[model samples]
Target: MKKQKATIHDIAEKLKITASTVSRALNDNPRISEATKKKVLKIAKQLNYQPNHIASALRSGKSRLIGVIVPTANRNFFSSVIRGIEEIANSLNYKIIISQSYDEFDKEVQTVEALLNARVDGIIASIGKATENFDHFEKIMNKGIPLVLFDRISNELEVSQVVIDDYLGAYQTVDHLIQNGCKRIVHFTSTQRINIYKERKRGYEDALKDHGLTVDPELIVYSNMQLEDGRKKMEEILKKKISFDGVFSASDYAIMGAMQVLKEHGYKIPEQVKLAGFGNEPFTSFTEPAITTVDQKSIPMGKITAETFFELLNSPNTDTVAKKTILKPELIIRDSSK
Candidate 1:
C-alpha cells in the first residue's frame, strides 16, 4: 500500500507542539516565533508537503487567478497586449488563464463560461468578431467578478473598457490620403455590427463629407475582412470598372491581401493607389513599400486594462463608475501611403 501523506498533526506530534502552533508557524504568522517557523518549515520540507490551492481558495474566496479572452492569438497585436497584461499580473502575484475565441461567438461563450466555473477573481477580454449577445459578460459582473474589455467592446455593457479611438484613427487615415491627392479612396471593412468597424466606417464617411466629397456607397465595401475577402473585393472592383485612387482597410490582414492583388494589376503604391490599414502589424513595416497604418497602442491598452482590474479589486465603493478609456491612434507614414 502507498504511504499516506503527512499531515499537520504528524508535524505537530514530531515537534511536541500543539497543532494550532504548527499551523501558525507554517502560515508564517507574525505571532509565531522565528525559531518555531524555521523548525516547522524544515519538517514540511522533509515530508514534501504542498498546500492545496483549491482548498485555500475555497476558504478565502479568492483564487488569485485572472481570466483573459482574445479573438485570436495569431495576430501580433493581441500577443503584445497579452505580454503587457502578464507583466502587470506577475508583479501583483496573480496568475492569468488565457483563452482564444478564434473570432467565433460560440467559442467565446464557451471560454467565458469555463473561466466563470474556474472561479477566477476577474476577467479581461476583447469581444469576438461574431459576438453580438453580451449577456455572458453581464453574468460575470452580476456574480461580482470584475470585468474589463479591450479592443472590441460593446457600449451596452456597463463594464470598464480600454479601447482605441477608431473614429479619429480612421478620419486621420482618410485625411492623409486626401491631402496626398487620393480623390476616389475606397474603404474596406467587415460588418458595422462591431463597434470598431462601425466607428471607422462612420469616420470615413464623415471625413469625406467634411472634405465636400460625395459619399459613394459603391466606394465602400464590406465583407469578413479575411484574406480571401480582401482579394475578392479587389477583383470585384476591377470587374465593376470602378475608378479609385486609394484604399483604407480596417485591418492589416485585409490590406495584406488587397496589396497582393493591387501589385499584380500593375498599380504603383502611393504614386498611383495610396494604401492604408488599421493595426500597425509588424508585417506592415517589412512589406515591400511598407504599408502605412494606425498604431492602436495595444500594449498600453492592455496595461491599462490590467491596472483597472486591480483598481476594481481594491475599490470599496461598490458603485464605482466604470472607467471607459480610449487611447488615440498615431498614423504611421510609410511607402504605401507616402
Candidate 2:
C-alpha cells in the first residue's frame, strides 16, 4: 500500500482557506495576516508537511546550504574541522554538504561543480595536492558564489582563506631542535605543490641560516608523505653514509614511519637521534617515545571558516573584508624531541 504525500492543498482544505492564501501564509508574505500565518504553520506541523527545500530555494533565490570540500575525511585534522563547521552552520540554520577530493585535482573540480549546480549559498574548501589549476575555483567567483579556503589554499587565488602560519611552525620546530644540541638536522617533507609545504620548508631553511648553519641540500628530502615512503627514505639516507642526529618530518605519519625504521636499526630516540613532526595527530602522542609536533588548531580553523562564510552572507559589501586570515601554530613538546 502506498501513502499519499501531504501537500499545501491538504493543509488549505483542513483550514478551510484558499490554496493561494495557504501558499502565501507558508511563505510568510507581508500581505498575509499574522493570525493566518500562525494557523497555517500549526496545521502544517500537525500534518507533518515538510516544506520542499528545492521549491523554496527557487522562489526565494537563497539556499541556506553550505558546501565543504576537503582532501580526506579519515584524517583527524579534517574530521575535527568538519565538526567545527557543523557546529557553526547548525547554529545559523544552515545545512552543510561535504565532499572529498582524495588529493586528486579532477575529483576536486567535479566536487566544486556539483556543489555549484546544487546552488549552495557558499563553499569552504581545502585545495588538493594535485590542484595546479585554479580555473575550477575561478568559476565560483564568476558566479558570485562566496568561498572560504582553509589549510591547503591556492597561493594565487584572492579569496577568503583561513590557514596556519606554517613557516613559523616549522621554524620553531627546527629552532627547538637546534636549541637542544642538534647540529646535523635533516628535514623530511612531501610535495611542495601546496603552500603549507612550501612555507614549512622555507621556515626550515631560514632557521638553519639564522643559526649560522649552511643549508645542506642532501639533508632535505622530499617524498610522498607515506609510511613506506618515510621508511624507504630513511634507508636511502642511511645508505648515503650520513650521520644526522635529528629529523623534522612535515607530518606525524611520516615521522612514525621513520621512527619504525630507526627502531629496527637499533637507534636511540632523543639520544642518538631526536625527531619532531607536524600536525599533532592523535596517534603522534601514542607512539612509543611519543612525538613533538606543531598544532595548527584545526578545529578552530573550521569554526572560523564557517563563521567567515556567514559574515560574507550577511554583509552587503563582501569585497570590503580581508580576504585572508592567517593563524599562528603552536608547538606541542613531547618526548620525541627531548
For each predicted model, how many residue pairs clash, with residues at least 3 apart or on different chains?
0, 0
For each candidate in turn, the TM-score is 0.90, 0.89
How many backbone clashes can be found in candidate 2?
0
- Report the lDDT tens digits of candidate 2 across residue range 220-253: 9998677787898999898888879899998887
Candidate 2: Cα lDDT at 221: 90
> In model 1, what are the clashing residue pairs, if there are any?
none
Error of 1 at 226 (Å): 2.6
Clashing pairs in model 2, backbone N/Cα/C closer than 3 A:
none
Each prediction's RMSD to truth: 2.8, 2.8
Please, what is the whole-model Cα lDDT of each candidate in the order they appear? 0.90, 0.89
In model 2, what lDDT does residue 126 have?
94
Q: CA shift at 98, candidate 2, in angstroms?
A: 0.9
Error of 2 at 136 (Å): 1.2
